[model samples]
Target: MKPAVRTGNHYITGDVACAEGAIAAGCRFFGAYPITPATEVAEHMAERLPDVGGTFIQMEDEIAAMASILGAAWTGVKTMTATSGPGFSLMMENLGLGVCTETPCVIVNVQRTGPSTGLPTQTGQGDMMQARWGSHGDYELIAIAPSSPQDCFYHTILAFNLSEKYRVPVLVMADEIVGHMSEKVVIPDAREITLVSRPRPKGRKDRFRLYQPGPDGVAPMPAIGEGYNVHVTGLTHDERGYPVMTPEAQEEMMTRLKGKIRNNLDDIIRTEEYRMEDADIVIVSYGISVRTGLTAVDEARRLGYKVGLFRLITVWPFPEERIHAIAARVKGLITVEINLGQVHYEVERCAHGQAATYLVGDAGGKIIHPDKVVSLIQEVFQP
Candidate 1:
């Protein structure tokens, strides 16, 4: 049977919509653990995976969950796992393992207030930086932020496609409020959804050159049972996938790992510009802050201020080139998020002194009111 994709519109939470999106993306394996504000994703997958001939296993812990998904992906199956702050942290070690082995997978982090279980049911964007740097080393990966139930449904598919396209783990950064908030989610028919498959290796096993990248830089992935001489290790390896510990070997291995994604920056970076054609200040934001960011832009316009919105749909890869060009044109750039300036630092670096940069941060319990965001605009733009 085809993946049990829920066709048409329905009232659902972001978590449920994400699970449905995964099914539509042709995910045939899921290794999950129950965590607050994110368990709904696993619960929905458990109910639906088997219906679509997919396997759903509830792991003992986040580490094992992360490991199980990576193992499943090696069998040429699309896989995913869902978790929150604490669990996301626990999976970091294995996350690196996935990256080093170039295992394609999707990891969803339904963020809740944290720094060690700060608040179980509250929302927060504290993990934004962690998502980029958490797993350690210098590997580049893709991560997307969804602001609503609809976006969670949409971007989860994009996350899977990108993971397969790049042969690395991709992240869906959702939050407590968005995850649990019920809203209208329009899931299209399975046939209408465009799914991308991982590139498959071809040629004789000895001549395959397992690590040899294709024209697009991503190497073709081969299944374990295939007759290919496949050997994958976390240590530095050559094109044949054999372990090579010398510094030269490490450089060659690391270069391909980072270069493949970095070389295709044009294809990886994605953003949204709202009413930004002519504006003096652009409010840069992603995730849940987007709700208030748009409100602030609207109110600022009402007050006769030249304000616009620059939303970061693909949170990682940072969209530096776009910001670099915009920074020169705008008088200033304001970054708003539910944490103390995590993405703010990225905006500031991209500004490069051409535009003044400001941060409108939240401590992460309740949503930041639009009034407060507009207050910052008035304070900054006013004489």
Candidate 2:
């Protein structure tokens, strides 16, 4: 198979492609427990890391898997973990820990069906909402959804880049279809990849405050043994890292943490628009559903429906402004997903009554077909 976009040699499964992407982006530590539809990612990392002087650990459970990655990140190592629905649920508590402490790492959720052990091998986008609000309290999260095997390679690298840039944990929310599917992925030469390294602490060691905010709202982080005597905690802390119980300190800390991502939304949010300029109806989708929606768009256009596709590459830090702009021009918005209406609410909220929002979804442990999506578009655009 020929490579879709030039990066390196082609032909790989999405999981192997993602593992290779992480290696290319400088990830040195992987902590994970094997889970179906996502196990290939861990297996590949274990095999690849040792050759490059990196470390890979298979933890006892998903909870341990999540926490171990955070510990590795504190040592200033680029770290990651892989899981499915059930395991993702287990990792939520520690995910909050990584966020509050501003730990930079990557968490890959190759989604499978269900609330609890629903379908171990079947694909579903049921965890879309969980990726944003799974952890407790208010915080910003970056989640990227890949539509194809090739994108899994590119987006995985981007996930690590974003994690390091903002000092926040990032999620690569893939699904079973893309994870197991084999396709050609072109990996770029080492020199061609634009890698983002975390900002390091400067100033005299004694004068340094680990939590001091920079102009961009992100604080420079120091590794555990960097001779900086840095202190880090999940609790709200003063610039020096001591626990600050005062309400003012708490407010300031939370504001900075959330503002870093919010203010940099332009760099953080990404999406793809297809045939949207003359589109009377737009099909909004992500992950595996996006592929189906693309086919639906082509078919609708052939039938003279004037339809288009909007594929979300970045799921979190929702593309509200872009969606609004597109919605203002389209007559209707159609959301397609494997799960029942998870992201549809977001489309509705962003569309804000500018156009009719419709959902074409299924919870039957498989993806919604493109033909079905085309049918929904026709029904909505009936004249």
Candidate 3:
């Protein structure tokens, strides 16, 4: 069998790096339908998984692809899938099934410009809100945005860890630019990497309740043939994992689903702050935009402007408190993204009029220029 951890430095695209990272993280099952930019991820997984004693399936479409991973996840193996915009939309129902059933898996949406196949070869960040709310209903999700090929390598592993820990699907939101761009990525020794598995039930198998929440608000998952009666469904089920058609059952199920993520905000949210010490204006961005935001912030600083970049590593379950705090102290907050205003609305809502918020964005298809970001910084510069 081929070694799962290919520990060394290699130059590769973000999609391939994501596959390598999943392999390193103990992900042994991948089900996906081929799509532009994101196809490289599935291609690499198809070639490498069998060599590592893992399974890779090219499902009929994104729906079956999403369903395959969730079913595979129940068998106690790490599972994942990859796709772009159109496939992502198709996966929403099953994605919600993954959520309602509390299935642990990673979904990598390597975004292309799109309202509907707007630009398959080009990059866009239009799916920011969709990643959070697309699945429907009231549920919290953990979405991480990777800024580079290296970020893709590291954060995909993080996505798996978080998914297993919380028993929810975690998203690695990458744009076409980051997904297709080649860069040097270092894969460390397997011993150096940390992996998380879902909590397992103990004691008598007959008495086990499948969805019973432990003190940590997460339930221990059992494999189907473990002699434990496993009943999984998308309906409102009690801790026994059987459907209960009542308002109270729905409330209880929803509480457990939402509480696990909402209660652990500090542990799940990650951001990188650049030059914020005494800065009066802040640039906020994630995924591919962070690269441009960093460049723009540096230029503004050289011109003697007090500016900084607040990079969102975890976009969903957004670091609202941190943004709100910064908004109060800064003269203005500028959000730079490829989308017109998905996350910008979140920032504005969090700012609460304490700071003026501006958006540096477009419909899709290209990365926002650093010069445009700098110009916005100049326009909003205070003294």
Model number with the top TM-score? 3
Q: List the residue pairs that clash in candidate 2.
A: 7-187, 7-188, 8-186, 8-187
RMSD of each: 1.1, 2.8, 0.8
- Taking the candidates one at a time, how many backbone clashes does each contain? 0, 4, 0
Report the lDDT tens digits of candidate 1 across residue range 191-288.
Answer: 88899999998777778877889998889999988888588888878878899989999899889889988888899888998889888899999988
Q: By TM-score, is 2 or 3 better?
A: 3
Identify the superior model by lDDT, candidate 1 or candidate 3.
3
Identify the leading candidate in terms of lDDT.
Answer: 3
TM-score of 1: 0.98
Candidate 2 lDDT, 166-273, residue by residue in tens: 999999999999999999887776777889988899889989988888888888989888799877888888888888999999898888889999999999999998
Off by over 4 Å in 2: 1-7
* TM-score to true structure, per model: 0.98, 0.97, 0.99
Every candidate's lDDT: 0.91, 0.90, 0.93
Off by over 4 Å in 1: none
Ranking according to lDDT, highest score first: 3, 1, 2
Residues 1-383 of candidate 3: C-alpha lDDT, one tens digit per residue: 99999999999999999999999999999998999989999999999999999999999999999999999999999999999999999999999999999999999999988899887779999999999999879898899999999999899999999999999999999989999999999999899999888998899988999898898899999987888968899998999999999999999999889999999999999999999897899999999999899998889988888889999999999999999999999889999999989999999999999999999997899999999988877776754
By TM-score, how accurate is candidate 3? 0.99
